[model samples]
Target: MGDYDEDTAFLGQTGPYFWTTFFLLNTVYLSTGFNGLYMVFIGSAPTHHCLIPDVNLTREWKNAIIPVTIVDGVEVQTQCSRYKLDVVRNLSAQGFIPGRDVNLTNLELEKCLDGWSYSKEIYQSNIVTEWDLVCDDQWKVPFASSTLFVGYLFGSLISGQLSDRFGRKKVVFISLAAQCVSVLLQSFSHSWKMFCVMFLFVGASQISMYISAFVLGTELLSKTMRVLFTTLGAFLFYCIGYMTLPWIAYGIREWRTLLAVLSSTSVVYIPLWWLIPESPRWLITQGRVEEAEAIVRDAARKNKVEAPPVIFKESELHSLTPSRKYSMLDVLKNKNIRCITLMCLLLWMAINIGYFGLSLNTSNLSGDPFMNCFLSATTEVPAYVVSTWLLKKYPRRALLSIFLSLGGGLLLLIQFIPDTLQYVALALEMTGKFGFTMCFSIVYIYTAEIYPTVLRNVGIGMCSSAARIGSITAPYVIYLGTYNKVLPYILMGSLTIASSVVNFFLPETLNRDLPETVEQMQECQGLCHGFRKTKYVEDEGRRNQPIQREAKV
Candidate 1:
């Protein structure tokens, strides 16, 4: 990409082509947000208890058949254990009053042999109820959510190489189609196993679509627009999609119907193939010089600007075509690149853990589940907006550290807020969500910039794969709430705060030109940035003069 940016500067940044591409890609991102968190409603468990038969028991005996347990200092009917049904029936048959004649609590308890009764106050039916994933089977609930991330793990690994080999626009549409098909198939699942199987594909396709679109935008747009598009333009649309989820689920309580509705909306995005072009920069890197030139000329025409007779310098075009292909390992082979990659991996992991952990925990928050979800999604809007502004004004490392600390500190602060002031606790949680949302939005743009174009998607994919570990673990983190309501927040907050320190060890990427090659990666400069560049780097730099010059530019 030596002199590539300067050569294509004629294609104005704020033009019809940029807007159309930005709008279309953001629409895809919107769908990602919608589908990504559907589990919040679909997997939520409503109030349930062991089913008691009415054939032989009195109303008092039926009530006494279910055992009660104290959880979180509150007396609640136990969901799993129940009094021995035969014993309860015998007591009632003897014309004995349960409390006076016998101690109901003294009766031995057993697992729910028949089934469970679920309340329909909020959800009419969900996966939890449909598959009896409660009590003894409760682990399946979180496992179901984690299955999507498991899909994401594998998807992120391959999608980058696929997009790099095929094309971004192709991968974007292909992934969208796969996402829609998988989601539709998931809606028809007859059992938990079937649902999870489809869910894996859903997760894979969704993240592939997300990462491809992100990298496409990064390459297709100008540096000035890239920041805006990657941050507010991209995530705001995602937030818009996220905000719609609770309302959609609010109307359609059944998981199958809800998924069908969400998947059906993909039809509108089909025509974007003609509207969005392959990344001109990506094409140049592949040595498809004429094709890349034609796209830029078409963009210039759409912008009402006169096209230069020659867009790319002959020397630059020759240099753009690499002697050999690059792989994800290229990022790890260099000390500076490897250090940045490792830091980003930890950063992305922590961000995903905090982000998804809070998002999935919205259902368990104190309020109407729909309102809590909507509020959580809505918080991301301001977070993205503020982040978009902060990114322009501050160094990336500082902003990331501040945002992560702010988010994590607020979550930790909730432990001090008494349970009596629930609104206050909820507000604190939302504020914590706000902080993590900002971190979430920034990390995408940050990681994209940290890596060079040669390995941008692969680098992002690797970090994204590492990030799935956090998302995969997030459900279990929230699952900790079953034991103590505050455990999830405490753990998430602690991790967020600790991960922020890693940013201080990484280099600042604000206002810097994106590295076009591994040899062009920025030097690490921070308090603890002690990594030393290898000796072969000097020989490589002297051998590739144009790339070295571009790095300095």
Candidate 2:
């Protein structure tokens, strides 16, 4: 058997164990989807205006006190200011009326000293309602959302090392528990600061669990199964959770209650510690040969396949070598790898910023916030389907460039769409989201394919870190919308366009073997020059192999 086949031979590529593991991992992924984007609903700001305190004045007088003001150059009921209530009451006693008997615009205005009243048409309660995070305090909403990504940033950096050191299964359970506890605690916070602090833990734990589960699933599944699990299995489950979030928020209405419900869902996975087995591959690397063999034996039994006394040959068992440890510096030391890494980082940052920026802006879109969120989540389904199909058929560079450009172009067009055609603007935004989702999905596979096995993990890790940086900046990008409704779109659209053009410089990985060494990667630099002809020649050569050898193989 070849080295690649030898490594996975004992775990029957498809069987009971594989299917069970797949289902269990996907279940965890489903729950993660809920916690991942719940911030959209949790921190949503509903329509509100300054509270006109009752000073025993007539209803007309009360109405007259809250004056209309120009916000973003549009005259609307002011959110943060009210007419001096004492003066308004005296004016009302004198039979003064708004607009006709008195010029309300010329009257002195004061801040919302009595606080604000929120419209409860859609939401009964949220972080914005619970703490009055509107008007002057509106900036806190995006800051609170950004804290979650800050946790994601830290979680992404640490989870990999922790998983490798302690084992994937252990890390998965620990992170899962941490996430559940943190989310639950976050629900009961009395102050926004307390909520934000706990939310940091929630974000960290959520991403850590996701990363660990992802690594575990990839390691446990077969090669083809790995592709399916990455693209369709866990990711689709996440989409389902995301699609369900809007409904959950709509139903619960209260942020605290919603969080409690979502956190309790984690309890369902407590039993998975027994159901999901430790990775046999990781065990073998750790020199736990007997334990690894035992897991394989159980898997074969579960699959109803007859097992040999010993699954691996002595040579196969000893095949693992302790190579020199490579770091991020090593990736940058190579000229080709360095260039690829830089391009991937920039591309990843742009995609992440655009994706999250669009997601967080759903509330501000011209439709029901819940329905808009649902639409955004729903778009991912087709995006994933299309991305899976295209990854198999098209060159990575071309697909990424095309998709990025398409998404960016759509976002750019949205700026030209007038408010009168808001539905059209919304449609364009959703379409842009679809394009960004495709780019997001493609970049993962592309990054993995570009780097050799030795440095693949490091290269992808660096890119992911860059993505977190983009995510950390996303809330602020969305916050820019408060200043100018089109600012976020303009910025995200421009960055995406620049990234798309840069993607053309990247080499194509389609039809090429995964490079196993840095030297092999350097040699494949020119492979993308005549991609179709090279692929055809390689296919034809394979077809011409001797019939006897083919039958033997």
Candidate 3:
């Protein structure tokens, strides 16, 4: 507090900010229904046995089976001869409470239901397939994600305008509660339609969390640490979700069980409300001078130092005059913003197209699907470690566009390899993974930094939703790969290349601030207009950097 810039003291951490944020993020992340584990959400039936409900089979088929129905038009009430009628009635009300009473055929050579039984079929999948998606029958998987993006899209539009309207701390607090309930309902949905409905609500909650919470990190850290640590979330929670999922994947055979297990973990966040500090920056912005200064004072006490002058307080709060409202249309009405929006959206779309597409395509990659996905994700841990340093020195647009091309290129080259070069293809996939992972982190920082703070969340949300558009298409590409292995790679590669060109029209954002409105964006070229270059020249220099060279190896 004593040595740092007056502007940044609000940004640096004082309480258990890091741990509290991690827990909040982990909550939404686990419910994201990522990978096959999330396969539970869309009701993809597990490849396992089911309890064959007792039904009145033809007399010949009925001998060994429990008769669920009778010819008298009365329900046989489950012909478990070993159990008393009263026992069956009480147990029936519970509806297959596993381990309670309906033991799955424990003793005799009893007939049982298979996975395709009505209950099992309904139990396995969510109603997302109804959207008539092109992704596996699991098209709903990405659609479910789209609902979330839609939620994010809306949140960004609303939260960016409204979060500041309220307070950063309040918006995040509200988002946390909203996200918890939305995800829980989605996980426990009784019908596919209901599930989709839940997805929509939960998606909003999710975006609110993403926008508000992500902003919290930036608000809590120093400028030096702001971009770096805030974006580090792109890596931190990602790795956690990536690693944490595999263990859950194997642990739960039932999709419902999987979702239940994941959704329940969010409950730990309830106590975080009492722990984490409110955003002082947000307080200052909303004209809560006294409260904002109080937060600063509390920090002074905790750090054992004196608070800064009253003039410093006036600077932050006075600048925050209540002004014109923001809306999604704000990005479109201005040329520079429109251009930046287009570029960021396309980049967001491409990265997810590659990221989630490749992720879902793990079914086609060699080895255990879960393990391969996990190992591939583990690659990002190191990618982010290197990215934190590299992003600062480089131009955001140039570096990201080149990484886009590189990611796209490796994907295309993998198609040229012979089946004899299975390992070669896998190696190429890793290279692409690393590039996209880096781009994924960069895009978030770059997008937020480029947009004005007024439309910051909306701009990022639009990009995130656009990313979902790519995401929606991604699963279908992989689903097709089920029939043609090379199809997804070829299509994904082409999309990436096409989107990379959009970066040319956009401004660079390297160590910069976002605009509040489109008017401000039109005033300047973009957030960082200092440097922009063609991907080729950038790649050449990157190739020379022996430590972090653009080599496939």
| Per-model C-alpha RMSD | 3.7, 5.7, 13.1
Best by TM-score: 2
C-alpha local distance difference test of each model: 0.85, 0.85, 0.60
Q: What is candidate 1's lDDT per residue for 51-112, written digit by digit as tens?
A: 88666888788877888788657889999888888888888898888788898768888898
Task: Please list the residue runs of candidate 3 whose C-alpha ends up more than 4 Å from where it truly belongs after superposition.
Answer: 1-37, 40-145, 308-317, 323-337, 418-423, 448-461, 509-553
Q: Write the per-residue lDDT of candidate 2 for residues 1-553, one digit (tens) a residue.
A: 1153464476667888889989899899888889988888878887788887656787787767777777645788877888888888888888877788998877888889888999888888989998999888988998898889989989998999999899999999999999999999999999999998998898899899999999999888877678889977877899899999999888898889999999999899989999898887788778787887788788878888877787655666554766678899897666667777888899999999999999888988877999999999999999998999999998988999999999999999998987788899999999999999999889999889888788988999899989989998999999988889999999999999999988887778899888666655632243123211111122542422223211110
- Per-residue CA lDDT of model 3 for 349-404, tens digit only, reads 88988987776665457556567767677777877877777876989878888989
Candidate 3's error at 78, in angstroms? 34
Q: Cα deviation in Å at residue 474, candidate 2?
A: 1.0
Candidate 1 deviant stretches above 4 angstroms? 284-293, 310-316, 323-340, 448-459, 511-553
Q: What is the lDDT of candidate 1?
A: 0.85
Order of the predicted models by TM-score, top scorer first: 2, 1, 3
Q: Which of the two, 1 or 2, has more TM-score?
A: 2
